[model samples]
Target: MALRTRAVLVHRRTELDELLDRHATRGQAEFFLRTRGRTLADVESRHEAAVSARRAVAASVPSDWALAEVERADLDRFLFAPEDVVLVVGQDGLVANAAKYLDRQLVVGVDPEPGTNLGVLVRHDADAVAGIIAALTNPPGRAGAAPSAVRCDELTMVRARLDDGQELRAVNELFLGHASHQSARYVLTVDGTAERQSSSGLIVSTGTGATGWSASIAHDRGGRRLPGPTEQALAWFVREAWPSPATGATLTEGMLGDDGELVVTVQSDRLVVFGDGMEGDRLEVSWGQEVRIGVAERRLRLV
Candidate 1:
């Protein structure tokens, strides 16, 4: 088929014609939920307004065509074929479900966060979403790729206590960074070595997170000024690219930094450490206890 399905954005303010233009060029159909900084609960009002403005828009489309922010439970509407992919045209905010799940293959992020593959982001107007959908239903090639990993009972989500007396949770990594400060200062101790830090903080991204926070700081942007094993070296190699190979390797505590100590320091006081990107743990932070961090074996699911 020559692609006829339509794709929808995250129900935010969007440029209709520009979106449609993508379709004109690509020969696909797309649409955006033109919004005005409305809350998830407020999409209904906006939808009503859109209906009043162009009743034909809704009438021509099926009743289940549009997805609302209030009830976004199923991915069935987006999933079509093994070759087809759906675009959840939205930003990372109150309306986004990226935080809710780690399905990068299905929910590709268009915007650039500290983590994530900005390269694959579907950054077009409403029309682009439609175009993508149209192109997907009758994709050009093979079905979805074979599975590499999935969730399991062996996999666990736990809440641990920081030396500073705060609790933290993680699925893949326990990343620490300056949310609003210039620097975050903390010592790194893998196994039993103490090393100081000069950067923002330490990061421990998982293999499951093949394209997230680990992807951002994976660059060797002069952090390796020191000589080889004598100076500080986090991993064996830091890719000049995003979503580097650092994701799938095992982090056996001895792979972080100087003498197995992954110390980190940012210029800011308001520091944050969490798994994925969702806020899990808050700590004042001090250097005393042997930070027991071990790379996890299992990963999670999304689509």
Candidate 2:
């Protein structure tokens, strides 16, 4: 069967929209923010910009191609087609969120609020999306109006798989720890070495995540090194590992090559494994269960 190319637009609700939902009215939301020494004008302006950007993207979709829209909260429930071109119109974090549900589809990050956002993941301006779609639909050598070829950066991702047939993937990092952020007990095995340890949690980060949370840890450890965005290897860290009579912190950190794996056996009553900070949607590992994390088989094709 010939696969149809669909454009999936993923976004999140604006702060103004969220406030209105909580307060039930714009006036109430404004008053609430005013009490905190804030105003609604900035929020409203950003909201309008986001709406305009989305409208522009929607209007630029090719007439023959299928289009679908999904909010951040509904991403887990949304079904993505195999031949889809996913467009994330939000911050870098939103790109990480949508990357979990995708496979081989090409992803384009659209920054709705240009100057405010870092544009690390949402790298394209709102007006450039039409050209991107045109170039994608009409690759080089094809008879079309596309002026240039779009460059795709295949970014690596991390995967966590539990013994119970559950799995998750992320563009940033995978966090395995207690749900309450308390001390977690587990047996960690990496690079052929094994040890029982108790700590806050474990963070397995990819090159893409090196600039975020993992970077902080690296900075703390006398500027310990991490991988680059396209690097095949990944870095793992055991947060605040405490040595005790029954546990050791010797195996607190290391790197995993393309063929390497990190296994953790749950010693606590239960532990949670979430990717890209989405703790709500996670895998639960019970006593004695082993959770293996490694480089994911699929890489994110970001345009």
Candidate 3:
């Protein structure tokens, strides 16, 4: 049987929702914000706008298509099917948060607050969602023809896989570090070069992520040029590599071209590997385990 189309609406809780949850009432939330010289009306307006955008997107789904609503906090528990049409209604970070959990689903990024958010990922305005969905679902060709080829940008992604088979993917960057602020000890190998090092951590960022955390690190370390969003290469950095008799910092940073891989042999008791800054959803490796980081074969199909 042919697969049924399902529209998965992804969203994050609004600031007002969070405040109400914490304060237990609207009046209490108002009082809490007022003590900080902030007004509840502003938060309420933004919250209403976000909620309205989400409802609009949800309403835009074709009547025959199955629909599912998922909060960002519950993404790990959500099962995304291959035939699902994912709609992320929020800022770019929310898009990044959903990208790792998806495999081949096409994502429509809806910016509720267009002018306020940096919409690098969430490119479409909320109002455009209805037409976008109609165009994607039912192209203008034949009476019962298949949908036309989707026009999408294949955004590169980074992946970290351990010898034990646990893995994580991120549209931005993968962070390999100690759970705490303590330095992480590991054997770092990149492009056939290996070194024992002690440092804060390591970051392998995709071109999409080159504009964020990795870029800041590169700028602080004498301005190493990074790649663009659609580039196939990845920029990596070893943060604060402490030099000592047993460890070296010479292999500080480099680029991973197509087919290149970075390997890390855990030397500490336990270290973590998390993507896109989601520390809670991570892989932990103990001493003697090896981790491989590279460009993920799966890319985020941003529509």
What is the lDDT for 247 in model 3?
99
What does candidate 1 score on TM?
0.35
The global Cα lDDT (0 to 1) of model 2 is 0.89
Give each model a TM-score.
0.35, 0.95, 0.94
lDDT of every model, 2 decimals: 0.35, 0.89, 0.88
Q: Tell me, what's the RMSD of every candidate?
A: 14.4, 2.6, 2.7
lDDT per residue as tens, model 2, 1-303: 345568899999999999999999989999999999989998899999999989989888898788999999999999987678888999999999999998867889999987667466778987899989878753333322223388888899999988988889999999999999799999998878899999999999999999998999988887878998989989999999999999999987889999999999999987999988888889888999999999999988888
Which regions of candidate 1 fall more than 4 Å away from where they truly are? 1-160, 164-166, 221-271, 279-281, 286-291, 296-303
- Across 78-192, the per-residue lDDT of candidate 1 in tens digits comes to 3433232233434433123332332223332233122232232323333233333323222334332323332111222223345555455444446565554344444444454
Q: Which 10-residue window in model 1 sums to the lowest lDDT?
A: 150-159
Ranking by lDDT: 2, 3, 1
- Candidate 3, position 241, lDDT: 97
**Tens digit of per-residue lDDT, candidate 3, span 28-104:** 99999999999999999999889888888988988888899999999999999877889999998999999999887
lDDT of 1: 0.35
